[model samples]
Target: MNLYPINAGNFKLDGGAMFGVVPKSLWSRTNPADSNNMIDIAARCLLVEDGNRLILIDTGMGDKQSDKFFGYYYLWGDDTIDKSLARHGFTKDDITDVFMTHLHFDHCGGSIQWNKNKTILEPAFKNARFWSNKDHWKWATQPNRREKASFLKENILPMEESGQLKFIGLPEIDLLENSELGFDVFYANGHTDKQMIPMIRFKGKTICFMADLLPTAGHLPIPFVMGYDTRPLLTLDEKEKFLNMAADNNYYLFLEHDAHNEIITVQHTEKGVRLKEIYTCNEIFN
Candidate 1:
């Protein structure tokens, strides 16, 4: 199996929001903010090439939102979803599965697009089976007030309407109980309800997609939970357990939102589990 890093592009978000309660004087060193106090973030996605199945995880924010809506998050970079896929000599039609970690706009917004009729929305990958959990599907569709802004309907509804949407597995199971998808699902609730983190078993090693749970290297600390998380305490618990396991087993964390680091390994330190080594995906795999 081969894995490719897909750069959907970059966008700007408030450093304060990204770091939560972490003091600016500290986080600013790594993620320097602009005059407006917004830090540049990468909308990084992952592509899995296994046999005939080319699975794309998390499509970056698509190009369908209105000018006013996009004004808030300043989108930048020339690397688009199509161009990124093409970089690997592939296209949207070659994708057989779109494994969405969650339904947030930055994560799944590119799953759909606007057609010739401005009013009509359609699946971005007409031939791909878009994968999301049943519970997450409901949570995003009938989103709560706090998360409603992030779960845009334009990014979601079209998949089901196009008859290409599929649920991975049962939500209540310890593991993703009914997920027909081949990968093992690590259920994490700290970021959102039943956010499925895919643990891909390849070449006798486990590579975890650290979707929002550990957004960046800076977030490895237990207290560095995102303010956007619905349950911060639950996130603390999940991170502690997951990080301990990752450290013990030497799992490579494939960061989704980290602007610089792509993969990292953690070691149990006196302070806590801290980053031991930072390397790109190919460096470890090759």
Candidate 2:
């Protein structure tokens, strides 16, 4: 099995919102903000080449939204999904599965694209089965007021409409169970419902994908939860548990939003599970 980090691109998000109550004095040191107070974030995706199956985890925001709509989040960078795939000798057609961690636009938008005529939407990965949980699917489709803006219909509906949606239910081991991976599913209600973090096993080490739970290495502290999370206290509990486990087991955390740090290892210190080391994924995989 081979895993590749797919760089969809980069975008800007408010640093305050990204790091809840954490004072600017702290987070700004690591993720320096622009004059507008927005920090750069990576729309990083993961590609897994497992035998005959080519699975992609999280598609970055696609280029289908109107300029007005996209004006809100300033997308930048030269690296695109196409170029990133080409870097690894693959293409959209080669993806057999799209495992979405959640349905926020930045996570799943790249799964579909505008058709040739630019009149309608079509599956971006023409031949892949898009995977999302049934419960989260319903929640995202019929989004609540707080999260409605983030769950855009253009980024979601096309998957089910295209007849390529698959559900990874609760109990299936080989299909979607937490035990198959080195880490267990520590579902948190804070950052949208049922946000699944894949506790991955790698070469005698365990690494986890910190989707929005810990967006960046700067967010390692327990209370630095994002304001976007529905239930902040629930997020605190989830982080406390997960980070403790990660420190105890020496898990390497893969950050989705951090522009600088690719992977971080944490150690149990007097201050808590503070970051032990920051290294690029290549340093580990190679």
Candidate 3:
């Protein structure tokens, strides 16, 4: 199996929001903020090439929102799913599965698109089967007031309407032994309910797609959790346990939102789990 990094684009988010209660003095060292107090964030997705199934994880925020709506996030850069896929000599039609880590706009919006003339919304990848879990599907569809803004309907409803949406981890199992997508699935509830983190074993290495569970290397410390989390304490617990195991087993973390760092590994230090090594995707696999 081959893995590739699919960079959708970069956007700016408030450092305060991204770092939660952590002081700017601390997080700014790793993720510096601009004059407007915004930190760079990447909608970095992952592509899995195994046999005939080309699975794309997290489509990034699509370019369908109105300028006013997008103005809120400050999207930048020329990267798009099309350009990223084309870089690997592939296209939307070539994708067989879209494994969404969660239904947040930045993660799943690219799964659907506006048709010619902007008359209707449709699945962006015409031939792909979109993957989301039942719990997250409900949590996103009937989103709570706090998270309502993050879960955009335009980015989600079309997948189901198109009859291409498939649910994984239906029983809400700890680890989905066989997802039928050639990867084991684990759920992290701290960031959002039932956020499925895909654990892919490739090239004799265990690579985990860190989808908000550990957004960036700066968040390696257990206390550094996102304010957006519905349950911050739960996040602490999940991160501690996950990090301990990751350090012990030496798993390569594939970050989704880190702007500069592409991948990293953690080791148990006196201060607890800390960043061990950082690598670009090519540096580790190529």
Candidate 4:
């Protein structure tokens, strides 16, 4: 299987919310903040080319929201699925499957787009089946007050409306077998309700798509959990368990939100699990 990091775009998010209760003085060391205390973010998606199946792990926040709605996020950069796919000699139409990690806007918003007439919504990848778990689909569609803003209806709904949406069953491992996509998913609830994390085997390495579990290398210290997580304590435990396995097996963590770092590896250091090294995908695969 071949893997490519699709650069969707860059945006800024409040550093305080990202690092939870961690002091700015500490978290700022690695993830520096701008004047507004907003740290840089990348909506990096993963593209997997195996056999005839071309799969996308996630789609970044699309440009379909109203200016008033998007202004709140401070979006930046020229990256988009169309342009990024061209960089790898592909296009949105080439996609056969869109595997969403969760329905958070930033992660799955690009699944749909406005039609040419701008009269109605259409599935962005008309040919691909949009994948989401049954539980996450329900949680996002009927979102609670705490996460309502993040789970925008426009970002979803259209997939189902277009008749391309499908739900992945429980026991995450079966997803790979069922679809023949060749990657296992790790279910995490701390970040949200049953957020699926992909564990992919490629080039003699286990490359995990670190959705919100380990947002960046800075989150390696264990205490740096996100305030948005519904269950921070559960996040702590999940991180510890995942990190231990990552360290023991030397897994390559493919970060989705980290602006600078594309990939990272952690080690069981004297101070506990910490970043061992960082690398670009080319450095590891090529």
Candidate 5:
């Protein structure tokens, strides 16, 4: 199996929101904020090529939103899914599956796009089967007021409307071994209900797609949960369990929202699991 780090785009988010109640003095040290108190973020999607399946794990926020809508996020950089795919000698049409970690706009927005003449919304990858769990599908479709803004209808709905949406059945426990996608998935509820974190075995190492469960290296601290998380206390418990397991097993964390740090490995320290090392996508994936 081959893996590619597909950078959909870069944008800035408020540091306070990203780090929750963590003081700026600490989070800013690792994720330095700009003058506007916004920190850099990457929509770093992952592309998996295994045998007959070319699967894309998460599509960054698509370009379909209006300028006014995007301005709030302070979008930066020229990277697009098309350009990133082309870098690996592929394209949108080449994707056979799009496994969304969750339905948050930043993670799955690129799955759908505006049709020519801007009259209709359509699936961006015509050949890909969009993947989401039944639980998350329901949660996102019927979003609560706390997360309503992040779950945009335009960014979703079209996959089901196009008759290409598929659901992965959840396991009775937190971990599902050897899923149909050809990897183990760790289901997380703190970030969002049934957020699927793919645990992929690549080149003799475990590469975990650390979605919002651990957005950046700065969030390695157990209590450094994102404000966006509905259940912060649940997040703390989930992080403690996951981080300890990650440290003990030496898992390579593939960070999706960390613009600066692509992959990180944590180790047990006096302060708990702290960042042991940082690697760029090239260093690990190549």
Candidate 6:
């Protein structure tokens, strides 16, 4: 199997929101904020090419939203799914599956796009089957007030409307081994309900797509949960368990939201799990 790190786009998010109650003095050291108190964030999606199936993990925020809506996020960079795919000699139409970690706008927004003339919303990847679990599908479609803003209808419904939406059955336990997408899926609930973190084995290494469960290397500490998480206490527990397992097993964490650090391996230190080494996508994936 071959893997590619797809750069969808980059944007800025408030450091306070990204790091939760963690003091700026602490988080700013690793994820230094700009003058506006915003930190750089990348919509670093992952592409898996196994046999005939080309699966895209997330699509980043699409370009369909209005300028006013996007201005709030301080969008930056020239990266787009199209350009990134072309870099690998592929295109959106070449994708067979779009396995969303969760339905948060930044993770799944690029799955749908505006039609020509802006008449109606449509599936951005015409040939791809959009993937999400039943639990998350329900949670995103019927979002609570706390997360309503992040679950946009324009970014989701079109997949089902296009008759290309598929659901991955939730595992009875925390992890599902060898899923339909040909990888183990570790279910995480603290970030959002039923967030599926893909554990892919390639080139004799385990590469885990660390969605919001561990957004950046700075979040390696168990208590450094994102403010956006609905259940911060649960996130602490999940991170502690996952980080320990990653450290013990020497898993290569593929960070999706970390603009600076692409991949990292953690080790158990006196201060608990801490970043052991940072690697650019080229260093690991290539």
Pairs clashing within candidate 1: 168-179, 169-178, 169-179, 170-178
Q: Estimate TM-scores for all models.
A: 0.95, 0.94, 0.98, 0.96, 0.99, 0.99
- lDDT score for residue 155 of model 5: 87
Lowest summed-lDDT stretch of 10 residues in model 2?
A: 174-183
Q: lDDT of candidate 6?
A: 0.94
lDDT tens digits, residue span 201-232, model 2:
66777767788888998888898888899899
As a TM-score, model 2 comes out at: 0.94
Q: lDDT tens string, model 5, 29-118?
A: 899999999999999999999999999999999999989989999999999999999999998999999999999999999999989989
lDDT of 1 by residue, 1-286 (tens): 9888889888888888888888989888777899999887888898988888899999989989899988998987788999999988999999999999999999999999988787789888878999998889999999999899999988998899899999876645545433355678888887899898888877888888988999888888898888889888999999999999999999999988888898999999999999999998678666
Question: What is the model-wide C-alpha lDDT for candidate 4?
Answer: 0.90
What global local distance difference test value does model 5 have?
0.94
Model 3 misplaced stretches (Cα beyond 4 Å): 171-173
Off by over 4 Å in 2: 171-185
Ranking 4 against 5 by TM-score, winner? 5
Q: After superposition, how far is residue 239 of candidate 3 from its true place, in Å?
A: 0.5
Question: Measured by TM-score, how close is model 5 to the native structure?
Answer: 0.99
Worst 10 residues of 3 by lDDT: 170-179
| lDDT score, candidate 2 | 0.84
Model 4 misplaced regions, further than 4 Å = 172-179
Q: What local lDDT score does residue 12 receive in model 4, on the 0 to 100 scale?
A: 92
Give the Å error, residue 83, model 2: 0.6
lDDT of each: 0.87, 0.84, 0.92, 0.90, 0.94, 0.94
